[model samples]
Target: MITINEAYVDSLALNAAAVKNGRDLVKKNKITKRCRTEDKTLLFGDCQGSGKEPYRCSVDYLKPESPVYRCTCPSRQFPCKHILGLLYASAAGQTFSVEAIPQEIAEKRDKADKREEKKKEAIGVGSDEAAVPKRKTNKAALAKKINAQLEGVELLDKLIRQLVQNGVAGIDSKVLKMMDDQAKQLGNFYVPGLQNELRELILLIKENKDSESLYTEAMDQLTYLHALLRKSRDYLTSRKQNPELAMDSESGLEESIGHAWQLSELRDYGRVQAHVELAQLAFRSNLYAARSEYVDEGLWMDLSSGSLYVTRHYRPVKAAKYMKEEDSVFDIVKASELFIYPGELNPRVRWDDGPLRSMQAEDLERIHSYSRSSFTEVIKLVKNQLKNPLSDKHPVVLLRYSEIVVGEDDSYGLLDAQGKQIVLQDTAYLAHATTHLLPLLTPELAANQAMLVLFEHELSSGRLIAQPLSLVTKREIIRFIY
Candidate 1:
């Protein structure tokens, strides 16, 4: 039988409620007919439910590292309460009879295997190792789309200018309604990105809670939207002339304008880096209310180049239950093929699933060396990136600190040996898990070690602040946020 513990079952829960419901099922003795294959590759059982018949569920561990939890329950959750109940039963050492796989499941598995083989053949990943051909861009179709996108860009710019000239006092419900309608129409113009931003701008205008704050954010959003329009128009115009142009590696304006990039295209455009080793410094999940999606963002450092990179996994809210949530990883990811998306100040990256192992002692030494010592240089670099309207304002950097300074405002800030200090505060977007955890560290260790922080420009304070993420010593890096 597959070895399992209650703690392991607990760790698999996506939410406290799910775990609680599962344990409740266990207590009620809802599970029955527990069985497993002779090899113990599959653990399956039926659990009594609200319906007349019990819900059939299985935990397929054919590939133990990537187990598949399946249940006939109507719940959208990947591992439904029934599946969890089964796992919890196994963890609780319930009696399970060894039996042959069900005929229906066996048939389903065979069909799935055939489908997998066909997919591998299509992707050129089969035993024969055939090379899949890259699809060429349809120039005529792409050029026509570019023209439409350019028209959308112009329409958006005109709307923005009208809004600016009319002033905030004139923005009533009718005006908001018109702007909202216009944003929806922009979707038909092949400018989903602009449409999203316009909606956000409209929302900012609608909320006048803090007038000063509203003015700051509204202006910032409007400024970025305006820049996006100009750059998008220029980009689409260029593509209109030659649709097969190279991907923009600099500003990533093509993608910024809502042009979806294929991984094959990015790779062919010289965005793939080989033999890249990345260590996850910190990870956070952000719910983008505007997009109605949850984005899992991980800050990673390139072990060889020591450059900061980001990995983003977006899970839409509607399909959140079906999709797996990307959690914090503690291993060193050694990817043979890494695809980097185009953008500034920590561009998003994706890599082929490959070797992952625990961090070694040498990994710590390399990470320590990557810590930037000069606050002056860090400030200059961050300022340059922030100047770009379309750039990510929250740039993450690792800083070597000498002391943790407590400001008169009762805020935490990091100070270097030469007395250059950067204040630390939790921003609205980047929530520091908890600043209270700072007191646990020894003052001497805190002074001598390096720290990873996310820099944000605080609108209310009118000052820049760094949100501390990880504290790094020579031996190991301790993370405060995920």
Candidate 2:
């Protein structure tokens, strides 16, 4: 009759530090029955991996003041998976009801009791059975899980090696398709972190232009994958040869410190290709006529190396209110240099136009529509605007701005100026929208040039949308703990 908080379960899922440790034990198969009774205790179960046979380990929560673990398993990793699983179970409100001991075990307990009784009688009635202790028994459940996990690592390693051998462009479509399927399988197994790592590797290779650098990176991933595979194989081999003997060993039941890996470390820049500026300006001139301010910036951070990259995505922000009857400070004038990226925050600018305190009703609508277009669409649209302010239905205008950089291996990432990294590797199709603002970019307005102007028109009114995009850098890579 122990009560567990639901929030604790959520914390367990999100807890970066704890999840790694817990996952390791799960992979090793050292945890079996996680019990949540009056005291959160773990009942040692059969182990199936490498270790001394007949391992004995249990968390005793019978006493809240001083909870302790009773285990014959050796090595000094305290409160191992047996304890962690028990806690997790309790937090999840999973009630533990001790099962009936099997007949054979019951008989053994009875015989032991008789022997202890006889000894107590020989000594004194008050004498206890302290001389006889519970014997350690081989665990069976854990071994099975360990064997399976090892197999998965092996398969993944082989797959990655094969992909690398095939070359970048060659493996691009096929490997990504395979990864998509593999990710689904891994997700079903509750190993999302592992899935993310694999995705990150694929993404890197996909985005790489240099075959040599890609091969090098692929080799590094191969190393890690191989190590994981080896560990799993070792665990499986131990269990198959002498399941009982291995379980009895302390190593069999105890949690192991995983191999040291630098998570979120980014490889060196492989290659860079300059963008081609279009020949003929397809944008209409009227697009920027009632405009105010525009800004777009890109930021990237490599988590492991503490590297950063910043790029810009620029677009004009339309004035809030455009009054057609009055003269305005802002006019249709093309600004230099524009870039675009995925994921950004709103960075809207506002200002006052000539003779008008705010924007007109019609001007506002035009500005709002301008704010909704995606960077690519916005740029082309703006170009059209600069060229012909009056032309409607531009070729690129109706073409749903839904194109993503095809076969991109490396998606953009972000890290704050403080070096905090956030990676967005598995990018799905980012649908075309009016305008989506990224957070990392700097707004185009400066001290001397205030573009976010509001023109007070007799009629038109609307709001302009702004967003900031940050460039990816080496330091913004996120690390994963195994």
Which candidate achieves the best TM-score against the true structure?
1
RMSD per model, one decimal = 3.7, 27.2
Model 2 residue 25 CA deviation in Å? 44
Quote model 1's TM-score: 0.85
Candidate 1 lDDT, 322-355, residue by residue in tens: 6667888888998877888888878888885546
**Cα misplacement distance, residue 228 of candidate 2 (Å):** 2.7
lDDT of 2 by residue, 206-256 (tens): 676477656665665555555544554565567666654422111211111
lDDT scores for all predictions?
A: 0.81, 0.34
Query: For every model in order, what is the number of clashing pairs?
Result: 1, 97
Q: Report residue 374 deviation for candidate 1 (angstroms).
A: 2.4
